[model samples]
Target: MTSEKLDRRKKYTRMVLKDSLLKLLKQKTFSSITVKEICELADINRSTFYAHYQDPFQLLETIEDEIIADMRKYLHTYNLQEKEDALRMTEKLIQYFSAKHEELQILLNKSGELSFERKVRHVAEQFMMNKMTSEEKNTHLPEYVSKFIISGSIEVLKIGYLRDVRNHQKKWRS
Candidate 1:
């Protein structure tokens, strides 16, 4: 295949793999999913799956990367110089999570693994780090603070979801 054709084929394969994983994630936890399942859902061969990803977890990482990339792209287009901007971004993120409650409940709450939380926290921290000014980065906040904030927020959200408190806008506001 020509270079362009090969690139196109690779893109198509990744798309297939992503679609397959998303479909499966709707049905089962990431931990329960297998290479055979992915290949079967993707309608691709084992070798092709292996050629792209070592496992489903690796594919999940790619999906997380793409998600963060899109988030960063939006952040880049904005003026992150104000505290309100950051707060709004966080609110937007919460709304995004609210929209994906079903998918997240399956992948995060049901999966019996902390990988989803870790990925979410990682992305949140990276987003904050990218937005911070050099002076802010230097003082007042330690590097671990971002992790703390992300994890704490996630824990709060998880609790809210578990208690069916997510539906109460007033409770969430408090």
Candidate 2:
């Protein structure tokens, strides 16, 4: 096969594996999920899984890494100094979260993993810190304040997103 075809095959294999793992996470904790189960769900061989990832945990880590990278990209895309730009940046982030709701809900709430959530909070905190003026940083208060704000913002985002999803489902049912 050509290199392009080979790369496409590899990408498809990884996508299915990641999707299978996320689906399984919705049903049970990550620790209870097995490589065999992932392969079975993915309809790919165990060898294929190992070719991409060592185990389920590594697969989960890969998913989390991708999410963090995307979040960082969104954060760095805007100049946060202007209030209008800050609001637009927030809207972009919200749109991203909404688009990835299922995957994020599974990772953040159902995966029984704290590390992924912490990584998200860290990313937000770092972005906030980076946007702060030098004088603000010199106060030593901005660090603590930013941490508090970022932590609260993340918790609100998670809770609010879940609530919004549940509300939508209810409306659809009715």
Candidate 3:
């Protein structure tokens, strides 16, 4: 029971810290963010922050790692060879993006780091390569093709999301 309680407390501390960092990312780039600011925003002590992360950059990297891991899990759930499965996977991916919209927006747009975006593309590319049919793998073209498609799709999602956010803001202000 004591161990469980400690686990819960640790989870809560990490949650608040993640939230605080993301909230700060909205106002400034990750490079400009400080450990002190994150702790103050989280209402957590700087020592506690250091206990969990080396710095704000590490915390951000942790967040990115979690996102990529989740994406990998999602990608692995479907056999992408079948048309129906592929369609279902795409739908699920969009749903995942919708669920993570705010966090993604901050990371993809606000963080001012291409690293996260590149990591996302790399994960997707790896998933595609692993799922490709033997025949498809024989041709080197699929590798390049998959990279192009994944990168374009991610860019389109980013642009479309930003446009939707702007439209929503306009509606809210009117």
Candidate 4:
């Protein structure tokens, strides 16, 4: 096969694996999932799965890393210098979540099996820390204080996300 065709096949296989994994996550914990099951779902060979990821957990972590990288790009695209910028960022985030609702549903589920919540919190923490660093304030707050505030903000987003999902379900049902 040509290099371009091989790359396309690789991309297709990886996407199938990841999408199957996310669908499985909605039904069960990641720890309970197996590489065999993932390959079965994706209709790929076990050897093919091993070529891309050591196991299911590795695939989960890879997806989380991709999410964080996309979020970082979103953060970089905005100036985020003022409160207005923050609000605008929030809107953009909500839109992003809405578009990726099913995938986010699996990732953001309050399951103890994955550290996705922490990964997202880390992104928010990093964004806040960068914002604070860019501004010249009278007095600098400790990192812990900033982290605490970011945690609170994340909680708010969680609540908003749940509410948004609920409303969407209602509209779908009706």
Candidate 4 weakest ten by summed lDDT? 133-142
Q: Tell me the tens digit of each residue's lDDT in model 1 across 9-97.
A: 89988999988888888777777889998889888998999998888889987876666565555545543556544566565555555
Give lDDT: candidate 3, residue 161.
71
Q: What ranking emerges by TM-score with the best candidate at the front?
A: 2, 3, 4, 1
Residues 56-165 of candidate 4: C-alpha lDDT, one tens digit per residue: 87898899888877877776666355544444454444554555555656677746744777777777656655554345333555356556755654554455564465
Q: What do the candidate models score in CA lDDT, each in turn? A: 0.68, 0.74, 0.75, 0.69
Tens digit of lDDT per residue, candidate 2, span 1-84?
245546888999999999999999878888888999999999998999989898888888899999988888877776454533
State which candidate, 2 or 4, has the greater lDDT: 2
Sequence-dependent TM-score of model 1: 0.59
List candidate 2 segments past 4 Å from native: 1-6, 80-95, 110-112, 160-174
Model 4 TM-score (2 dp): 0.70
Per-prediction TM-score, please? 0.59, 0.76, 0.76, 0.70
Task: Give the winner by lDDT: 1 or 2.
Answer: 2
Error of 1 at 43 (Å): 1.5
